[model samples]
Target: MKHIPVLLDAVKDAIGDMRGLRIADCTFGAGGYSRAFLDAGAHVVAFDRDPHVANDANMFQNKYGNTFRFVPETFSHIGEIDGLFDVIVFDLGISSMQIDVGERGFSFRADAPLDMRMSGKGMTAAELIAKSSVDELATILRDYGDVKKANIIARAAKEKLPQTTFELRDLVFNPNDVAPVFQALRIAVNDEFGEIQRALAAVPNKLACGGRCICVTFHSLEDRIVKNTFRDWTTPPGDARLPETCPAPFKLLKTVTPDDGELENNPRARSAHMRGVIKTC
Candidate 1:
């Protein structure tokens, strides 16, 4: 299935009138957000760790000329970029193309090597399972996936050390969701939460005055991170009794979710939420 960007219209609305604006498309999955920003007359620098997206990034560079730049790196290193952007946007989590491709091992429907690394680097899901103890695996499953039978599944998984998607999926006992187990393992393998935290940390420094930071998160864990970070960014410091009003460095923007029409068209967007904050200082 082709990748459909979730909450795209809402994101565009959040950044209103992008002409002559500089945007950093932090996730750049399938280049959906980048294309939309460019089409709206913005200069876009797209970043993605996954090498599979190079072809798409190349297409953007070729088509948009100097208006578009592709950075073949993770968003966590966003601080290293030289320019201050008018907007930074993140569409987090795996793209549909990754899951659809059976060889990527993001989905359990196909029997493939348990390689869930987004950048095709670092620890593979198979290696993660092999190295983690039953307790560690149980923690990952519980924390990331919210799996009910985390302990039971973790014990079985650690003992078997499944090297393929099918092996792991079959190893999961009945009445437990295999999807969450895979989700937890994939997040751990990619260090997704850590990546998100680091990328957002750079936003305040990378954004120009009055610039905005936007994030579209699909799951509660990531959504909570964005929400808390944005809150911190927009909250004012100092004593409340001073009466010397100290304005927050950033101001929170409206939160958006998929409308009925979008949900009908893309069920994957049902869980998506878009939150944004504008730099006030």
Candidate 2:
């Protein structure tokens, strides 16, 4: 299936007139955001850790020439990308390509190796399950997945560490818990929360004065991180228990969600949320 960019129009609106702007497409999943930015005459520096999207990045480079550049790296290291950007957009979580492939182990629909690494490196989901203690697994499920029966699932999963998607799914009897458990495993395997923290911390330094930062998050965990980080950026130091009334560096923008039209066409966008902030200092 073709990967549709979620909240496409809203993202474009947040970036405003992109002509002559330097933008960073932080996730660079399928190059959707980058393509849009390039089409609007912006110079886009796109980053992605997944080697699977290299071809897509190459296509963008060929199509946009000097107007586009791709970096095979994670957004956590976005700070290393010399110079500030007029706008930075991060579409977080697994791309549609990953989930639809079945072999990527992002979805429980097919029996595949329990590999959830976006970069195809690091420990696999199976390894995570095998090594984590019941307490650790419970915490991952509860915090990342918000699964109510986290302890029960963790105990079952620990008895026989699932080597494949189907094996993992079998542990959760309730169909509703399957998705959350899978999500927790994926998040744990990818160290997603840690990466988000790192990326958010580095974002302010990479944004130029009056630059805009836009983030698209699918699940609540990721959305909360984006929301809280933006909140900190918008809050005065005095309110945060600091000595002086140090003003925030960015002004929060309106949050956006998919409309009925977008939702009807793309069911995957149902959980998507988009938030933006503009640098003030």
Candidate 3:
């Protein structure tokens, strides 16, 4: 299946008039957002932990030349990048490419090994399950996936230690749990929440005044992180009635979700939400 970017129009609307601006594409999955920025005459520096995306990055580099650059690392290392940016964008969560290629083990629909490492170098999902205690596994399920039968599934997972996607799916008592179980494991395997926190921490210092930080999040856990962070950025410290001397660093922008047309074409985007904030001096 072709990887259609979720919230492309919404993201574009968030960062209006990209010409001659500097953009940091924090998650260069499938080169979707970066391509859009480059086409609009913005200079883009893209980062992706997955080594598999190097080919797609190369295509962008060849097509965009000096206007584009790719970093072969996770967005958690965004602090290491030099210079400030006019715009920074993150398309969080797994790309369709990761899910489509079943060998990568992101989707349980395909009978692949239970390996959902985004960087292709970390511990596999199977390894995580085997090493985690039942209590630890239950917490991951409850916190990350919000699985209804987290305790029961955790105990079963530890006792059986399934090594493949199908095996893991079978461990779940309810059909509805199959997706959450996979999502919880994927988040744990990638340390996705930690990565987002670290990456967002660097944004204030790296973003130019009047610049924007936009995030398109897929699930509640990730969306909560983005929403809370944006809220903090846009909210004034202390009493709201305090003098106007100390202003909030950023101003909240419009929040967007997939429209009916987008959902009809890409049901995977149904849960996606786009939130953004613009830096205010």
TM-score of each: 0.95, 0.96, 0.96
Evaluate model 2: give its lDDT. 0.89
lDDT, candidate 2, 1-281, per-residue tens:
87999999999998889999999999998888888889889999998999999999998888899999899988888889889899989999988899999998888998999898899999999999889999999999999999988999999999988999999999898999999999998999999999988888888778888999999999998999989888778876456532122234678899999999999999989999999999887
User: Model 3 segments beyond 4 Å from truth?
Assistant: 237-248
Off by over 4 Å in 2: 241-248
What's the count of clashing pairs in each model shown? 0, 0, 0
- Please report how far candidate 1 places residue 246 from its true position, in Å: 14
lDDT per residue (tens digit) for residues 1-281 in model 1: 88999999989999999999999999898998999999999999889999999999898888999999999999998999997999999999999999999999999999999999899999899999899989999999999999888999999998898989999999887745798999999989999999998888778888888999999999998899999888777666663421222234678899998999999999999899999999887
lDDT of 3 at 271: 95
lDDT of each structure?
0.90, 0.89, 0.91
| Number of the candidate with higher lDDT, 1 or 2 | 1
All candidates: CA RMSD in angstroms?
Answer: 3.0, 1.9, 2.7
The better-scoring model by lDDT among 2 and 3 is 3
Candidate 1 local Cα displacement, residue 156, angstroms: 0.4
